[model samples]
Target chain A: MEISYRDMITVLHGMGFGVLFMLAFSGAIGVIYATAVVGPHWPRSKWDNAMFRFYLISMAALAWLATISGAYIIYPWYRAVPPAGTADLSTYPRALLLSNPHTAGWHDVGMEWKEHIAWFTPIAMTMVAYVFIKYGPRLALHRQMRNAVLGFTAVAFFSTAVAGLFGAFLNKYAPVRGGPDIVLMREN
Target chain B: MSVEQQPTGSGAAAILAAGMGSLALGVFAFAGDAVPALGRAFTFWQPTGALSGVTITAIAVWLISWFVLSRRWASRDVRLGPVNAAAFAMLAAALLLTFPPVMDALQGK
Candidate 1:
């Protein structure tokens, strides 16, 4: 209800990351779908092409929502503290569970989900990529699909680049504030 | 090019109906944040409050656009081409940019 500057910035930033995450993830999946999944079993009609396009668009939207719920909240929270190897929060006053690994439970849940999604992201994208590359070129209605793929792929690359830059920025400016190692450790 | 006959009246009616329906629902979804009685009933519609409003408004915008486009290009195979792709990417990018990454940056790794 109350919109502070900080909240505004957070929402805006989260939205950006959410969109970036969706575009990149969808693009990557389109590539995989084209080369892997759809190549051999490519469709043969206009209906099929339309359906595939619909599928990709829907999937992209799903990835956007899922990643937003999982990553934007959890990843940022997890990063609030420095990496475990570099620093320890065990000595802090009241030993806030936000920083404490021993007592907190849900703290790691978000990060775990975030990491889990991150891990599976490439696999899912591969499936999407297959659709784009395979059916994309051969559609009777080639123009729309082709244009979509080109746009999708461009976002895939650009967003990934931007993500890396943001990653680096976090490393320098915010630095990892330590928290429970539940999710990170479990994934590794 | 296969030319499908455009929907002259029924299609326009359908689009209008769908657009208005979506717009109404979206409005209802957000009405709770302001009105106390509606707020109680609809608060559950969106646990997160304002975020739900944003979602409703965004969806309504898209639906309205779709309705207009459908009316304009009814029955004709929508000529989706590179332009659509570029436009979609740009739109997505603009939306993404507004989702400032700094907070996520501060919150988690």
Candidate 2:
């Protein structure tokens, strides 16, 4: 098995960070809902509270890592302009998609929307983490604050879902490929 | 602090600041996409193009606003009704502004 450097990084960005972050949402929402909605009946000791805070903070960190890597690392490669009159545009994912009318929307709508909307995830998630950490069990006492936290969490999930969906489809249509091949194994 | 003694101001500040940050990002992104000059100006890093500046600036706006608001409201209990309304409105606007179709329609494209 072998994989190129670019492909490896792309997979890490989307699968490692992005998908992991999305998967964490279910546990996060469940715990948060239990704490806020179920109120004092949730059976959270100090240890449980500490663990939940750590989980939320980690989610926020994952969100930051995903978007940062996408924007700074993978995006530059994806948007790299091909050399003049280049026959092969495979190295430039953005250009490859734009060059064909059938796939142009993938770049126009998919990339443009994904790149920008994905950012909302980190911003909203950070707030959700901070608010939850600050209020904890007390959140149930403040109905408005609890509502705001829940609302932002839902929005963050929606933003992430949109970005993740587009990312998967974009890669399917015009993948970011080309780099030094790293061989994993060779048949004798 | 007990649950009754805990103030809501700090949480409110964080919420409002997030909304502000979201709005800042949407506005910067929309402007960068619609205006060539602004787009070029926002290119702080050549490799990443305008995105580098847009995200960094929005983060700065978020953190700064959060710090300022937190400092001012840390111990006080502020009315959340108006704050929640304003923050949610901005959040909705940010969502709409970042959508390409909405942006295109507003730009008459």
Candidate 3:
């Protein structure tokens, strides 16, 4: 098996960081809901509080990593302009999609939307993490604040879902597929 | 801080600032797409095109607003009802404004 360096980085950005961040949402929402909605009835300890803080902080970090890597690392490669009269546009995912009528919408709609919308995830999640950490279990006492936090978290999830869906579809249609090859295994 | 003693202002600041940050991103993105000059202006990084500038500016807006609002409201208990309503409205606007179709419609494209 072999994979190009670019492909590897794309996988890490999409699966390693993006999907992992999305998965973290389930745990985050559940815990936050339990803490805020269930209130004092839920069992609590200093350890639990500390662990939740770490969890939220980690999620925020993952969100930042995903968007940063996507924007700075992989995106440059994906959107690189092909030199004049370049026959093969495969290396440029954006151009490759735009060159074809059928796939044009994938770039116009999918990439255009994904590029901007994905950002909201990090911004929203960072606030959620900070607010939760700042208030801790005391968040349960402030009903409106709790509702706002939950609403923001939900929006973060929605933003992530939109970005992730488009990212997956874009890769499937026009993959970012170049760079030095790294051989994983040599078949005899 | 104890439940009774904790101030909601800090949390409110964060929430409102996130909403504002999101709104800034949407506005910047819409302007960048609609106006060619604005698009070129937002190309702070050549490789990433306008995206680099758009996100950086939005983040700066978010952080600065958060800092200013937090400093002002940290100690006091601010009303959250209006704040939540405003924040959620901005969040919704951000979602719509980032969408290409919605952007296209607004631009009469």
For all the candidates, what are their Cα RMSDs to the real structure? 13.3, 1.4, 1.3
- Lowest lDDT 10-residue stretch of candidate 2 chain B: B1-10
* lDDT value, residue A77 of candidate 3: 95
Error of 2 at B32 (Å): 0.8
**Model 2: how far residue A167 lies from native, Å:** 0.7
Residue-wise C-alpha lDDT for candidate 1, range A25-138, written one tens digit per residue: 554445434633444334545576557566666555544554455344434443343445745543221123445465333223322222222322222233234435334434
- Candidate 1 docks with a DockQ of 0.05
What does candidate 2's lDDT look like per residue over A1-188, in tens digits?
A: 89999999999999999999999999988887786667754535777788889999999999999999999999999999999999898888999999999999988888998999999999999999999888887887788887888888889999988888999999998898988998989978
Comparing to the true complex, what docking class would candidate 1 get? incorrect
DockQ for the candidates, in order: 0.05, 0.64, 0.71
Q: Give the poorly placed runs of model 1, Cα more than 4 Å off.
A: A1-62, A70-72, A75-140, A175-188, B1-60, B67-74, B79-109
Model 2 per-residue lDDT tens digits across residues B1-109: 2344489999999999999999999999899989989999989999999988888998999999999999999999998888889889999999998899998998899
Instruction: List the candidate 2 regions with Cα displacement exceeding 4 Å.
Output: A41-43, B1-4
Off by over 4 Å in 3: A41-43, B1-4
Better-scoring candidate (lDDT), 1 or 2: 2
On DockQ, the leading prediction is: 3
Candidate 3 - chain A - TM: 0.96
